[model samples]
Target chain A: MISYMLCLVLFSVGLYCILRKRNVIKIIIGIGIMEYAANLFFVLLGYRTHGRSPIYAIDQEIKSMVDPLTQSVVLTGIVLGLSVTLLLVAIAIRIYERYGTFDITKITKLKG
Target chain B: MEISFIAIPLASAFVVAMIANLDERIQDCIACLAALATLTLSLFAITVLSGAGSSGAIVYKVGGWVPPFGVSIVIDGLAAFMLVTVNLIALAALFYSTGYMKKYTDKWKFYALFLLLLAGINGVLVSGDVFNLYIFMEIAAIAAYALVAFGTTAEELEASFKYAVMGTVASCFIFLGIAFLYGYSSTLNMADMASVLASKGPSGALLLASVLFLMGFGLKAALAPFHAWLAYAHSSAPAPVSAMLSGVVIKVLGMYAIARIFFNVFGITPVISFMILTLAVLSMIVGSMLAFVQSDIKRMLAYSTVSQIGYVALGLGVGTPLAIFGALFHLFNHSLFKSLLFLNSGSIERVAGTRDMGKIAGILDKAPLTAYTGLVGALSICGVPPLGGFWSKFIIILACIQAGRPILALTAVVVSILTLAYYFKSYTPVLFGNVTTSKQIKAKSLFTMNAPMVALTVLVALAAFILIPVVGNVFMDGAVASLVRGISYTDVVFEALK
Candidate 1:
């Protein structure tokens, strides 16, 4: 229970970094942290004490096993997170090239 | 098969990308052909839905796996309606892109990305499970982010970055919300989860998920508070992309998902209704009131997208059968007219080589087809009589009144008038007067560009025919019935499995 709350705390910390930081790279890092938190939470949901790997054999009876479904979900989530982070970094690199700075406050090329 | 909707685009996207060394003409032709194929398949999906009759949803289980085991593709009336809207606009956008994309280098990349985006949208529409929906949504989002930055200019990059941040944040919340749902219900299948949730009744987990979804999907939809990114992103995207984004992307990603999950899965509650209503009203006022202030033609349309989405929400928030029907109708109409308008903007921009309304005055002399199409689009969006927008707004307003909400009805009328004012501000200045040529581009893409705009204009003008009882009854009844059935959606899914 406490670990679950800690995961969200990490999420909040990441959110804080995103909201407060001006550096483009830092914001990207913040997004990464938030994604990690969500993935951690999903993985945690499937955990069980003394649960074995979700393998079934014809010779042995299985009493309890960790939920493998969520592990797969988390795996997909991690891949998606990598893609998003890669895209963000690519865009960030472009921003630095165009604007010569990482400060989001300085990147005011677009406005109404 | 519904599988073809996702398969064709995915396969074509790879083909376009692999043949990068080939001629640009070939890439454009392949992309356009793929889009047409999807459009036909979408029509087939709709036809199948209608043939199955009201309350019929064809469930295509993947690999012959039974329901609640493997991912399924369910094409209910609502999914069919949404698919047709998506693929139709996708075809138009592909056609327009052939003309507009000639200026940009590596046009093949754009076609590949566009097809991938369409596949994501189609996948989202047909997916029966929540996780698959999320995956498809991310695919669409990534493609959209890349496309918005396709120009690679400073402003375009900045806009794409900003949009990515906002969109990613929204997606995270949605993911977190799905996590909560899975933890509570122990299933990812939407129908199965809904049944489990119904039997279990409401809990803290469910409530939390709902709030997270409202925030997440609301941002995706560009509803009131979360609409800031839309103006920058939509305006910065290439013209046809702007059309695609405003026309069907928001509807499919945000509005369709919300309606399906909340109305069909969670069973819309009074609280949810009230909250959505408040946001709808806010979006209406904010979107319309701010639209005319922009100098950029695409930006103005972008802001208007925010408001038009508000009108659709107004119907949805009301939660009456008539209102839902009106919402869906408005959704369909807005896709035609808004895409038409965006394509017109692209045409004007192509000819004048500028998007600022002040500089492009009286280009009607230069481009009569674009001007006239722009006028038709403007009239339709403004709810002019006999036009598509008018009928939907009229129906939504009437639905509000019948639901005993005169104030909401009045609000709809006021927003429509406000919508008219901003469009008037744009068209009168942008399309009229004898003005200079401004800055014209060297390349001429008249045939490829005007063809799609003209096609959309005709559709927009004839859109009222959708409301004719015979057609409307067949076209709209099942979609509405699906929503009105609420949580009974589970029954339909389970029944189809048999």
Candidate 2:
């Protein structure tokens, strides 16, 4: 229960950074943090009090195992996060080249 | 055959990326051919599904694994309907891009990303596993991010960055919802999850999951308060990209997912329905009101998209069979006219050298074809009678009244009129007034660019015929029936998997 609360706290922090940060890079990091928190929560959902690795062997008996599906899904989510982060960083670099600043407030060329 | 919807585009994207350097024109040929092929497949799927009846959904398990264990692709009435709408717009936009993208340096990269985006949209339409759907959504979303930034202009980059950040946050929320759902049901397959949710009944966890999903997908669909990213993202992208973004991306990624998950998987509760209704009404009023004042052509169209999507959401919120039918029909019609309008704007931007309506005038004399098509698209979107938009709006309002929501029905009517007013106010001066610009019009509306607009114009004009009893019974009724069946989707998909 405490771990879940901690996860929510981490997610809130990331959301705060995303909402409050001025630097494009900081916002990207914030996105990464939020994604990590979600991923952590997913892993926690599958955790047991003393669960062992989810593996199969013909020779050995398995008693308890953590849910492997959430782990695999989280791994996929991490890959997606990596791609999004890489793309965000790449775009940030291009933005810096054009605007010559990392501050998002100054990058306000597009408006209604 | 079901997998071919994803495989063909994926392969084509790969080919475009690899062989792009060999020849400049080859990428264009490949991308168009791939889009055409997918469009053909979607048409075939539609016919097959309609012929097979409502119980005839096809479930193709990945690697021959059954549900609750392996991923599956389910092609039902709704998927088939959405597939046709998505592929049709995709084909037109790819053709338009061939000409419009010549202004940019790297045409091949654009085709590559475009095909990748198509692959993602098709994948999202057909996937039966919730996690698989998320993966595909990410694929489409990432490709869209890159495409939005394709121009590398300052405005485009900033818009793309903002869109990317907001979109990613939405994805995180969606992922969190999925995690909660997986934990509750102990399954990732949508059908299995639906059955589990049904057996378990309503719980706090499920309620939380639904709210999270609403926030996430609502942001994606640009519903009401979550719509800030749309105007920037849709207006700043290249015109064809904007067309695809407005035409089908939001519908498939945002609206379709919402309908499938809320109505089918979760079984729409009264609370959810009420929440959706409130958002729909808010989006309808606010979006059109915002659109009325935009001077930029694409920006107005973008806001109009937000407004129009409200009608779709309203229909879904009403949750009557007729209302869902209206929503689906409007979804198809919007894709047609919206893509046409955006493509027409691209042509105007190319020839008139500006998207600012104040600076451009007398398009009817300058580019008669573009002007006429834009007029048709604008009129259709404004819900003019005998055009596609009118019938859908009529049905939605009628459904609202039938469902005993008189005030909501009244709002729909007034919003429809407001939609007409704004579309006319923005487009009339550009299409009909005297030539007023001092800039030299390039006058190079190429055949490739004009062809798609003409095709879409014809579609926009003729789409109303589908509302006839004979055609609607055959095509639209199937989709309506599937959604009306609601959580029975689980049984149908499970039976198909057998």
Best by lDDT: 2
On residues B173-292, what C-alpha lDDT tens digit does candidate 2 reach at each position? 999999999989999999999999999999999999999999999999999999999999999999999999999999998999999999989999899999999889999999999999
Candidate 1 chain B lowest-lDDT run of ten = B436-445
CAPRI tier of model 1: high
TM-score of each: 0.98, 0.99
lDDT score, candidate 2, position B493: 92
What is the CA-based DockQ of model 2? 0.94
In model 1, the Cα lDDT at residue B42 comes to 77
Q: All candidates: CA RMSD in angstroms? A: 1.3, 1.0
lDDT of 2: 0.93
Question: Chain A alone, model 2, TM-score?
Answer: 0.95
lDDT of 1 by residue, B151-212 (tens): 99999999999999999999999999999999999999999988999999988989999999
State the iRMSD of every prediction, in order shown.
0.5, 0.4
Best by TM-score: 2
